[model samples]
Target: MEKFELDILGCGSATPTTLHNPSSQVLNIREKLFMIDCGEGTQLQFRRNKLRFGRLNHIFISHLHGDHCFGLIGLISTLGLLGRTGALVIHTVAGLENTLRPEIDFFCKDNPFEVKVEVFNPKVSEVIYEDRSVSVKTIPLLHRIPCAGFLFQEKQKEAHLLPDMIRFYNIPVRELAKIKQGADFVTEDGKIVPHGRLTIPAGPPRSYAYCSDTAYSEKIIPVIEGVDLLYHEATFADTDKARAKETGHSTARQAAQIAKMANVKKLMLGHFSARYPDNNILLEEASEVFPNTVLANEGLREKL
Candidate 1:
């Protein structure tokens, strides 16, 4: 199986508390790192977790909220100071470029690396980034401002070769690649062997969705349906539903409702309100609706 994991750096909402930092996470797919939402103290959290700065090349910011993007400047400056020469790509709405470019130019005047900003609309669902291993799509979210979520989906894998069949047929090593690509094999005598007979079907692709700073919106269900892992904001408990709505945040129950509606494999809730003395109440509230829900916390890592 391909290696896919998520590392939580900060999970608090609005402000950083003594117990929690704000929104930041790193998604590791096949050893490549993609950072999501650089909130305050994100670099410190990265240091605490010992994440390699050089490995991270792309950052996807959901919105312009302070809690979601306050740490970006500091992180960029630190990367330059560390002598990183690789290009850094940041994907966000176009409005941020006007606000952030001046700060970057001033602080990183003599930096060695290039900062590439790729803007995407927060009102449409579209493929923002794609490579051989995975593709990332934008999920238009219902937040106070123009906000968006992200869906990281793995590409379909090649068929698994049956070693016993290969040995029995004395198949040439050079032909294996073609077979895995679904081509039929022909013997020297012109006898044909179907590719299906020599290989097992590939495992289904895995996906992860990140939704935050948005109210409960069903429009995202089709985009995130059946994802392997879902990280949704649950900033308030069910008792605070009104507050959640008024603030463009989702309650724990609301997050769970979304997860259930999407039929996701698992739900991981975060963006907790500082008012909560403990997050267990929120977890319990979400679990009542979706039994496979878990709470997001700093340093928590989930592998799929």
Candidate 2:
């Protein structure tokens, strides 16, 4: 029951409009904030949503497109201005250092915190980051540029202890940890108390996958198989398939196809084109193919 939520900051494509900003989202896992894709006006959206900036330490950028990363510098500068002292880790492609280092040096010279950029190749899928509770892996995506998606997977937890069984067996408190780790207990009378009797099965781990600015690619289905939630780009309708193909984007139908192929629990369609007055058409199209499809709107929060 720990917190696992996705907060949508911006969900529009390249052309900014009055209805939406750009691409940005915050993944809150057990109160640890991991930002994905900081597009234009991201800071304003964050403030409007009242998300705590201090809790955000790591950022994952999908690509180098302006709409995907233009707000990064501004957000970094504002964090410095707010007297943030913790280091900020940015996981992105290689060439970004050339553009961001100089800007950080000139604009944030007096800032107390440090910005650490970790580069990863977008052509191959690999584990990029890992901690005690979660592990993040890169999903190579097909885009105009070298782009990669991210998969957030939670680690398996220990088995739950059964208090009633423990009391009946008179198991000592000091032996609870061992029992949870699948160790058997021996009673004072030399009787065996199996570990299965003292603990119940652990809950299944949950996972989330984020894919944006990429064309329909089946290579990612195996990597994102059976995820709890999936966020995919739906930049056009079926009528605009030609444009979607030329721009290395996906139509609503294409996104739904990928979701169905991957067999994810729920699908979220985002990165909407500005031409559509409302996303009802896109939603309906995706829902037709994948029944659990939902539209991503700014300030929307989904819990997994």
Candidate 3:
């Protein structure tokens, strides 16, 4: 495992309640900090959780909703005040820069860092972010407004070369790199050495999917199929499922069904409505449908 974990900043829905803040999470993939949403008080939670401020360079906003993005200015301002020299990039749907650019210019004009806002189309599914280790694709979600979820998939890991096997075969060091990449080693004498005999097979790559503020749509099952972890919004229980359907949100059972349908390893439900004093009922409802379900609360962290 190369340090892949998720931290929940706030899990409450639109309203800021005493029990929870709003929708916000941080994914630490190979130590590259990526903020999923910047709800109000996100920076405070980020600091409360002791995540390094300098390591956070990219923020992905699921939509333009206030709960999903209102904390952008405050976080950017705090980063500037802390003298963060790295350029901060924001990826979200179009029309967010128009709302945040002015505030950023007015509040952080003197800072050394630059805040760059990049827009993406929510209607289209595409890889919005990619690096050497991971690729994040957008999952078109059915929400009240234009919104999209994120699917984070780790790149295939390279197999480890067995020193004993290599030495026994007397394989040249020059061919070790290729062997590690799943290529067979061909000896100078024209003997075929299988890759399995030269290196240990690496485990399959891990994946995580984040789905929030959307209705229960089977359209996403293919996009998030067989993920290691799934964070889906469970804004209501079975009792308030009518409310959920009216508000473009999903019930706890609905979230669990999505996980079970997609064959995900585990399901984490978040974005709870503020009316509930605690999420015990929601958890119970979802667990009945999918036993391997967990409730997301503020400050909770889990390895993927």
Candidate 4:
């Protein structure tokens, strides 16, 4: 309930199409924006969505593919032009820092903020970034080149204090944190009030997984199991399964199969190929396999 939302900036594949942009998305947890895959046109889309630039301190890139990272330099330069001073941390596979550092240096020379690039191995899974609210782990994906998907798991929140119960027990304001952490309230007369009586249990933590351009691989099931929302690339329909295999992308049916096998709560199909004028064929193919499937469109927001 504290804002676990995904904003789709672009959903098209390698070929540029009038229907969709490239690959970019923003996951907002508790008002903190975490950008994933800043494809071309991502900066414009971010502004169109009215997201505050200052809140975005981290950007996670799945791979070094052009469509996935072409917008990084532009966004960094824009952040500088906006007079932002906060350090921007980019989490990606190795070689990205070396590949983009020069461009950033030449363009962002007069910028106020520092751009820090963190590298990780795409062959193995690892916890790339974490905060008090959430933890992000990489799901090693199979692609033409090295690629990794991201799995975001929310950390458990503290129990909510009951206002009426707090007032009745006369618990001091300074003791709220302790009570939320499951400490019992003690009355002045030495009577013990159980923690359950003073607070409401926090809701279950939610999770989201993103796999943009990968082949159908069951190895990711254990990592992404039972997530609230699963966004997998469905670049082609079942009829073009051969094409999908050749390009290291998954068909809609294949994506749904992964979702169903993982027992995910919902499946979002994205990274559409330009060949399909209407993506409903892909949606229908995936929905048949997983009934709770949805299409990922530009500017679309899904909460989990």
- For model 4, residues 1-304, the per-residue Cα lDDT tens digits are 6999999999999887889999999999999999999999999999888888989999999998999999999999999999999899999988898879999888889999899999888888889999999999999999999899999999999999999999988899998999899899888899999999999999999999999789999999999999999999999999999999999999999999999999999999999999999999999999999999999999898988
Clashing pairs in model 4, backbone N/Cα/C closer than 3 A: none
TM-score of each: 0.96, 0.95, 0.96, 0.98
Choose the strongest candidate by TM-score: 4
- Clash counts for all predictions: 0, 0, 0, 0
lDDT of each: 0.93, 0.94, 0.92, 0.94
| Alpha-carbon RMSD, each predicted model | 1.5, 1.5, 1.4, 1.0
Estimate, for each residue in 234-302, the C-alpha lDDT of model 3 and write its tens digit. Answer: 999899989998999999999999999999999999999998898999999999999999999889999
TM-score ranking, best first = 4, 3, 1, 2
Candidate 2, residues 1-304, lDDT tens digits: the string is 8888999999999999999889999999888999999998999999888899999999999999999999999999999999999999999988888999999999999989999999999888899999877999999999999999999999887789999999999888999988887899999999998888888978788899999989999999999999999999999999899999999999999999999999999999999999999998999999999999999999999998
Model 4 Cα shift for residue 232 (angstroms)? 0.4
The parts of candidate 4 lying over 4 Å away from their true place are: none
- Using TM-score as the yardstick, the better of models 1 and 4 is 4
Residue 67 local lDDT, model 2: 97
lDDT of 4: 0.94
- In angstroms, the error of model 3 at 120 is 0.9
